[model samples]
Target: MASKVMMTPGEILREGELEKRSDSLLQLWKKKRGVLTDDRLRLFSGTSERAKELRFHSILKVDCVEHTRKYVYFTIVTTDYKEIDFRCTEESCWNAFITLALIEYQNRRAVEGFRRHRFQRVASEEQQEEPGEQRALSPW
Candidate 1:
């Protein structure tokens, strides 16, 4: 059994078996089951030493979330144009959790970007003006 590793910082929004579709010519349509985390999706073939990690930022989108009688299926499309399919039991709702986590991650990044831009702008404005001509800070 592979001992679990501690999560670095981000809260794990979801974790479970996400069977990844193999892209090798030999495996063709073969699926490899592995553990999925909010920050990265990893697959290990019988040993933790062989784990493969796919980070969330590298993922372009989660598409084709559908379900059959047995399982819910979805595809993760990476920025590099790689498509990895995953299937989980219907009750797991892996698709919904991944979508929500991706959205939240994007929102956090946008807010941080805006804050950085605003800080730079304010600093530049202050630098351009003389100390005596500095504008009063707004109460808001």
Candidate 2:
């Protein structure tokens, strides 16, 4: 049976190793330790340095490119249209975890945005009402 991948709300999502395609003349595949958080995906190099970060707010979508018998290849498209390619073992479900975490982060952001907009609208409406306006009391 296939394993299920789930995201932790408002927390670090997942951490694992992923093979990323480099943007060099040779275009080599390098191993990276990926830490998926609620707000960003942080990648660390095999050595001592932290490599790259892909924030969820700037990430547009995750696209699955291909699935071979041994690995799953996917691409992450950023809001600025930067495409990052990644591959992982088939059983690791890296693609699924990334997709799910991205969606959850987006949904949370949408809800927070809606709340802010609604609050601002309500406040504006309240301010627009004449301060000295009188209202009849409801007969209880």
lDDT of 2 by residue, 1-140 (tens): 99956756547678889999999988899999988887888899887585688888899999999999999999999999999999999998999999988898899889999999999999988876644244334333
Each prediction's TM-score versus the true structure: 0.72, 0.84
> CA RMSD for every model?
7.8, 5.2
Please identify model 2 stretches exceeding 4 Å from their true place.
Answer: 1-10, 131-140
Pairs in clash, predicted candidate 2:
none
Q: Which ranges in model 1 have alpha carbons more than 4 Å from their true place? A: 1-8, 26-38, 131-140
Error of 2 at 52 (Å): 1.3
lDDT of each: 0.71, 0.88
lDDT of 1 by residue, 69-106 (tens): 88888898899998888777788777777777676667
